[model samples]
Target chain A: MSEIHALSAGLALDASVIGGKAHGLVALMRLGLPVPPGFVIPTAACRVFLETGGLPGGELAGAVRELEAVTGRRFGDPARPLLVSVRSGAAVSMPGMMDTLLNVSSTGDLRAAVREVFASWTAPRAVTYRELHDIPHDQGTAVVVQAMVLGDRDDHSGSGVAFSRDPSTGERRPYGDVLFRSQGDAVVSGTVPTLPLDALATREPAVWVGLMDALDRVERHFRDVCHVEFTVESGRLWLLQVRPGGLSGRAAVRVAVDLVDEGLIDRATAVRRITPGHLRAAAVPRIRAAAPPLPSPDPASQDSATWDRAGSGSAMQAFPGSDPPSTGSSRPVTEVGSAASSGLEILARGRGAGPGVATGRVAVTADGAVRMAAAGPVILVRPHTSPLDLHGLAAAAGIVTTTGGLTSHAAVVARSMGKPAVVGATGLTVRTHDVVVNGRSIPDGAAADADADADADHMATDGHSTSEGTTGNDQTATDGRSTPEGTTGNNQTATDGRTTLGITATDTDQVVMDGWSIPEGTVITIDGTGGEIVLGVAETAAGDTGPHVDRLLRWAAEESVA
Target chain B: MTDLTVLHTLRCMGFTDLGRVASAAGLAPEEAESRLIDLAVEGLVTRVPGAFGGWGLTEAGKAEDARLAAEELDKAGARAAVTSAYTDFMVLNPELLDLSTAWHLRTVDGVAAVNDHTDAAYDARVLARFADLDRRVSPVCAALTAALPRFGSYRRRLSAALARGDLAETTESYHNVWFQLHEDLLVTLGIPR
Candidate 1:
């Protein structure tokens, strides 16, 4: 009991001993959430392990026995083997910088896995993370060993990461990524693209209800926003991890204001929960919604037709600088331009990472991006980024990753740089120079080749001179070749000597002017809040600074005056 | 300098001026420039024409670098050691990106904003951690260099970057150097990034 805390309802352990993650897990268990049965080898055990290079001598075996009893499965058995995950939980969270040994068992004497986790506390990256975050290196990480619920074991199984609300807009609903028949790793790594969290409602309704209930309970208990990682095994939900209060910027402000109204927390606490950092982030305008504007962005009120409208906008929705036009709400999806005979060309849609609008020439490779950026703003599109793409990412105006998700390296870097980014745009093929999106080749008109040249010349002449952005850096050309009835296929040439240039918008709500076969250098705007990458510039209004933001700031003003 | 050295330098830098390529390759600018010309003639390198133009590898050059890098690894009998170092590097990669991000933006009030570099205190803290990271990776770089001599340039380049407090996102800045070095490792190991 002194060295290990069994994860059950009423054990009050501080974060320093059990670490932030384990502390959160304990909270989840106490709240009656469906957390997997496990015991935490406290940070005290980790400290001793660090000094002696050994695990808390007998705590691991005893904990495993208890886990076995709770899960009703034998560890390392050939038949129905009980696999468990060992994760490092430091007092401070340094994500993606530590080791996790999953599927550990007794045959390897579990102690080795325990030691590995302990030793990982000082692995080069983890050490750097602590130093950067001002965390004391001496504070070790607690290892939480829990029985693994196989997310990929059956048809009704899955894994997902859910936020109490949309991290992008602070919308009060369970929003997250769900991977069916896969493990938690896919959900975290974002390498394998996942479905919207709502997909769970249809696939495994019971797990979905349990997850929704768990998110609600966690929000009520924390009195702030939170997210959780969970696995559904054969229709059974098992919560793996939970952390509270990660909403930022506008989302953070809205959540605080909403919570106060919901009477979860007092106005003073709500004001305190939001900081000036969140205000600045909120001030950053998001891409206007692509789906025809609903009364509000209520996912419940949305339908397949809404996505069709959002995805079908083929023309310029709004002019640049002036509040871009909104796609009028009355349009039906079936009446999309005659070109919509093929499945709607989704130019590119991904999980929006950082919030803002940017339009630029698409650069498929880092070299092309850096070179293209010198001429004008470049949207760096990649299958996925590695450390190598840093220079190109820096040079570009916005970032697009066909792979990776919110926490991927690209997402983290993009947010840090305050660059608008769209990630995990599935089915996007960055074909050398041309991009194939939503399974359609683009820019199939010979007339547009000469027009594209004229447009480029115009942009080169006018974009810098007439463009009125405060940043003084957006010289991205926004001309897509119109009148698209020409040769279509790979390497198709034109009537003229030049090749075809495609222009398309990177947006959520598709308007009429937008067409399937866009030319290159077509400027598309990426909205981080609405998670919309609109063609041309989507309208951007000032931050609503409405009741929620105003109340939060008023509380701030009142506190300062006090 | 050998043609492979010139071609690989261009490969690592992505697109860069002659001065940096020479420095990265440990050759005089003239030596690198002369070899680059020969590479261009061989269709392994191309000079982009524009304000942003620099000597860079063509597709042929990248294919050539991969051929020679794989050859170099096989000939030296160091694929196992280099591959092992790569595994360790991947572990550190995310944290490095995290550090770069912390440098680029900081949470102010409640929003993420660009770090204006006005806060010497904050910048210093980030730099100190960067130095600490560099210190830990030194041995890994040393191990790779011992296995493959070409990797020695990375340590020299990174150490020079660390000695200076310059970690900006410019083309030749410390972060970009580390980025190029990371690419060099992957290219040498024949791994797609």
Candidate 2:
């Protein structure tokens, strides 16, 4: 059998042979999506090269000749040279573990690039990744040699990765980041800030429409949420890669249920797709709108309003403005609370680096965090964290950074400590003794004094601010919320001045929004699951599966009974 | 000449105790304390009086350390070598961070959970990768050491951290030492953080 196979609809090879990337390209071609013409050197060829340290003599040359004939361009010709990108595609994804060479226009360079990619499979980092992920080492990666589509070809050109749905919220909206007049590498490098994918719609409407159509078709074919990497050359859209099913937790559950409603999948498939881990992740306490005094007559309209309110909290919120939920049949799985209804204002929003909800007083410095933690839970806020902040991070209940992304040092450490973290709050400013968020300069140390006063006052009134009382309240809240009679139990708990979970009357009384400065001991709630930072303790529904999860679980039970 | 070794070490390590400064600078705790006191008299460093506080550089100490680092580099005529090494270090830096993150969080059933270090095989796999990365970083370390002798301590400190299984979380962990080295490179090159 030939070692090289043309990437086409008719290519009949297992992913284990051609690698997942090439197989996806084959699927794209089969679906009639525009993909750059390419030939794949299967894993067999890579194995042979690894053993012999040389390419098979005439096979590569012959493939290149066929490619040249098809494209009407020569490999090394100066005018209109056939530039190509050589990429590594393993059966199991080992992201960022191998190398890719782009813009290769010469035979010699192509050969050398192929060799480097093959050798990279055995690179120490890649090997370690494989071992950690339990991917077999002996199965080599296929080399995908594709005709390069220049994203930098003109002012109308660009590259980006688009998700069929919002990966974070699992809202059925096309979402992603795009870089104009730059290659795909720049988008992934994150050195340059990217425009939201919707920008492509206004700038290159034709490409945008084509991309939207392609996304819809791929989602239908895969029967799940799909992500595509694409480049538009002078306004023509060409998909470079396609991947399905990377959504997790709440997003995954939402997508599964939505897919069932769309008739692309059945109830059984939807229930089967959601694992127990997804349920646990979905149950992680999220910042939701406090239950409305009266349920809205129309839940669907209320759902959209809730989405707008929740999205408005983030400066980088990338929802499709003015678009209703994609599926009318799908209900809101997680209802977010509005500021007016919840009686809590969002101070700032960021990327959720860790998962869970934490309520604490703000501590601007690491030292302050340690000192304040002796009295109450503290949230360590920083411009960016370093090794020096390790102790502060350890001591804090949660972490917030004014700068840095999800993978920053602060984020990594916070996750290690199992603390909820929010990073990349661009509107936040860290001063010497305080933090400024959304034009409000909050004093750090003054809150500590205020908390002491509140404690003294609380002792005089109810004696519930003590450590033992707080623990008892927490235990009652946890047990109450787990019972079928949770709503009544929670209402009763809230009626008592000091028995609400993570909140006390003294805490709420001090939550006054005075001219700019929120004292250091003023309570705030952060939802690391949704990246929402709310002033004062916001109500959290820890185990509420919501309407979507409830409907899916019901279907699962019915399917089992049948 | 004032021995700026202890001062620079403190600058790179951030606010740390005398014991950490001594261990990182390859000096005895008493010797490190003596130098810190001398620097404190000059208002280059200060000791915060609290449970969380320790010996740390003041603004003056930070400026002095930067100046001294620049002068040391020029005197050794090692700026070019150090810069080249820094370039190489940047390539490995992300990979190291990725490894550290992998050590802390592992995906189970597609949800990332804190690694409890219960899975012995998984821990062994991650540790083996750290060892592999350490091997690859040796050349970069050698190049930096050739440029400045103080950099030789990093090679020893990193290996010791790995040997002690202090991959992350701890003050003396491999990740912490690597972070200091990154800061040292930026300071030595007179680059902004």
The interface RMSD values of the models, given in order, are 8.5, 8.8
Which ranges in model 1 have alpha carbons more than 4 Å from their true place? Answer: A78-80, A289-356, A365-377, A385-396, A404-427, A432-519, A527-532, A541-544, A558-562, B73-88, B108-111, B144-148
Q: Candidate 1: lDDT of A508?
A: 19
lDDT of candidate 2 vs native? 0.69
lDDT of 1 by residue, A295-393 (tens): 433322321121111110111111010011111111112222311332232244565556666877665556556656776787776666654455567
Residue A352, model 2: lDDT of 67
lDDT of 2 by residue, A255-329 (tens): 888888779998889999988877776676677666533333221212211121111112122211100111110
TM-scores of all predicted structures = 0.77, 0.77
**Clash count (model 1, backbone only):** 36
Clashes (candidate 2): 3
| Maximum-lDDT candidate | 2
- On the 0 to 100 scale, the lDDT of residue A257 in model 1 is 75
Q: lDDT per residue, candidate 2, B17-134, as tens digits?
A: 8899999999999999999999999988877665666777766777888999999999999999999999999878877887887787676676655577999989898888889889
Q: How close is candidate 1 to the true structure, as a TM-score?
A: 0.77
Report the CAPRI category for model 2: incorrect
